[model samples]
Target: MADHLPPVAREPAAESGTADEPGVPRPATGDSGLRRTGARGASGPRQAYAAIDLGTNNCRLLIARPAGDSFVVIDAFSRVVRLGEGLAQSGRLSDAAMDRALAALQICADKLRRRNVHLARSVATEACRRASNGAEFIERVRRETGIALNVISAQEEARLAVLGCHILLEQGEGPAVIFDIGGGSTELVLIESGPAVPRILDWQSVPWGVVSLSETCGPEGADATQRAARYQRMRSLVDEAFAPFAERIAPARADPPTAESLRLLGTSGTVTTLASLHLDLPSYDRSAVDGVIVPATAMRAIASRLSGLSLAERREVPCIGRERADLVVAGCAILESILDIWPADRLGVADRGIREGILRSLMATGLRRDGAGALRTGQDAV
Candidate 1:
C-alpha cells in the first residue's frame, strides 16, 4: 500500500502574473522566529516535523524538515488499513479493522522514534468522524502506540486538502476547485486565487468515498453489464450528494466555464492511481505523476474503461494489483461525477494532500494577518 517515491521537493509552477493581495501573506518557514529544539538540545540539527493522516482506507505518515519556503520530505509511509472497513453497516469500527489500523500505527510509531520527530500531528478522517467508538479508539492508539489521533471535522479536512495541493492548480481567471477523494468521504473546496495562497470561497464534504460507496453499492458485479450498472449507481449516489454544492456555486458563474476559465485539481489515491494508468507507466511513479495535467476526456475514458472491467481484470492491471482492485471502480465513479460538475478541460493531479498541509501549518509561526490588517493566529493561515 505504500506508494514509494524518491525524496525530492519540486516547486510548483507559479501563478500567471498576478499581483499579491494585501493581508494574504504566504507561509514563511524558519525566518518566522520559530526555533528547532531536538532531543539533544537547541543546538542540535533542524527540527524534524511529522504529520500523520489516518484515513478510512490508508494510514499515511510524512516526516520532513523545513527548507526555505518549502520542505523536503525526509521519510514517508502509507498503508491501506481500511479502518472503516465495516463502519458503514456497523456504525462503528470493526475489531479487525481496528487491529489492522493499530498494526500500521505501530509501524508509524517506530518511524517517528527512529527519525527523532520533534513536532507531530496525527489526524483521523471520515471513519473516526462517524464512528461511535472513535474517541475510545483514539485513546487506545495513544496507549498502545504513543500516538494521539485527532479526529478532524469534515470542513477542516477540506481546508487542509486545499492548502496542501492548491499550488498544482492550473493558472486561471475564475474560481478553482480542489478536491480530496478519501476512503470514507470526499471533500471539495472552491477557492478564489490571486495571492500566493488562494482564499477559500466555499467548500463541501460528502460522505461517499471508495469504501462507503463500494460497500453501499455492494461488491463489483459478476459480469460487465452488472459492473456497469453498479458503477452507474455509485455515480448517481455521489451526484445526489454533490447537488447542493453544485447549485450553490452555479450562481457564482453566470455561464458555463470555458477551458481557460475553470481550474480543477484533485489530490487522492484515486487521482494519482488513475494518472499513473493514464501515463501507462510500468509502475507508480510520483515524480512523473505529481503536478502532471491530463485531458479531462482522457481521464473520463480511463474511468469508463475501468468501470467496465471486472474485479479480476482490474487486479491484473499494472499499478492496480489486488490491493486496489476492489475499490478503484468506486474511485472512478467518484472522479467521473466530479468531472461532470466541474467540467474543466484538463484535470490537475496532486500526489500530496492533508499530511503536507499539516506539515506546512506546523512549520509556520501559527500567525497570519487578518483582512483588517490585524495580526491573527490559528484561523487557517496555511
Candidate 2:
C-alpha cells in the first residue's frame, strides 16, 4: 500500500510539549476546552477525524483536522503485516497474519484514543473480502482492538482510491485512468473529469497483486534466464486478467495516446517505489515521490532492471529492502501490464490512496451533534 499522507497540508505538532511518534499523534495536554477550534470557525474544539486502511500487505492510519477545503494530517501510522500471506493457497487468513494485523490495529486504536478523534472509519480490502474467515477476522479485530473493520467491495475500493488521488492527475483531454495495485488485487478506473470530482465511466478489479501474483506464479527464479522466463509468465497472467477491461476501453481511444492526450495516475507501493528508484533517492521520501510525473520509458526500464536481479541483489537495493524485495517483482509485472493498455507517455505517482479518500468523505459531510450530544456522521457522503 502507498503511504497515507495528504498532499494538501503538512502535519502539525501535537498539543503536548513532548515530541510525538514520527507520524503518530501524542495525547493532548490540559483540559479539552483549551483545544483549537474547528475549520468552520465554530466555538467548539476542533474535531479530529481518522481513517484506517487495512490491506493485504500493509495496515495504515491517518488522522487529520478540517482545514478550509482540505485537511491537515496531525498523526499517522503504517505497518507491513502481510495479512494475505497464505490466503491464496489456504482460502483463509493464517493465524500469524491475523496476529500481525491485530498488533498493528491495536497501535492504531491507541492513537485514535490519544488524539480524541471525533469520527473515524476503518476499512479492510481484498484480503478480508476473499478469505473464507474474513468476517471472523473482523469480529476478532473489533473484540481485541476496539476497531470496527468494514469489509468493502472491489467497486467501492476503486471509487475511494480515485477520490483520494485524482487531484494529482495531470491536465489532459479525453478520459484518464487511475489505478491502484494492491496486495491481493489491482483496481483500474476509467473516469472523466467532473466539476468537483471525477465521474467514473467504468472500472475493473482483478485478482492479481503483488502477494497473490507472486505466490500463484511460484518463487522468483535463481538465475537471470529463469527470472526472465518467470517475469514473462507473470506478465502473461496479468495481461490475461486485464483483457476484458482493456477491450472495454478500446472504443474510447480511437487515436494513440500522446503526452497531452492520455493521462495516467497510479496510487500504490509499486508506482511510488519505482518513482523513488527513478529519482535515485538514498531512501524512500514521500514528499519527493508524491505527485511527480515520470517518463513511462524510464519506469519500465527500472522495472526491467529490477526483474533481472536476483532476490539477494533486490534485497540490497535502497527503498525495496527485505520487506518488498520478494513481492516487488509481481508489482513490476502488474505495472507493466497497466502501461501496455493505457500507454501513457508520463505516469503520475500518488503517495495517497484509500485513507485520504476516506478522510475527504468524512470531512465533506460535516459531522452533526445528535440528540444525546454525541456526534453522528452523514450517510455515503463521498
Q: So what's the TM-score on candidate 2?
A: 0.87
Off by over 4 Å in 1: 1-45, 253-256, 366-382
- lDDT (C-alpha) at residue 154 in model 2: 88
Q: TM-scores for all candidates?
A: 0.86, 0.87
Per-residue lDDT for 1-382 in model 2, tens only?
2223254433333343211111101112221111121232232337787788999999998888876666778888888899999988999999999999999999888887787776677888999999999989988997888787778878888988988888888766789899999999999999988877888998899999999999998887779999999999999999999999999998665454454488889999999899998888888887778888888899999999999999999999988988899999999999999999998878989888998888887665444442235333333111
Off by over 4 Å in 2: 1-45, 255-260, 367-382
For each candidate, what is the lDDT?
0.78, 0.81
**Most accurate candidate by lDDT:** 2
RMSD of 2: 7.3
Sliding window of 10 residues with minimal summed lDDT for model 1: 15-24
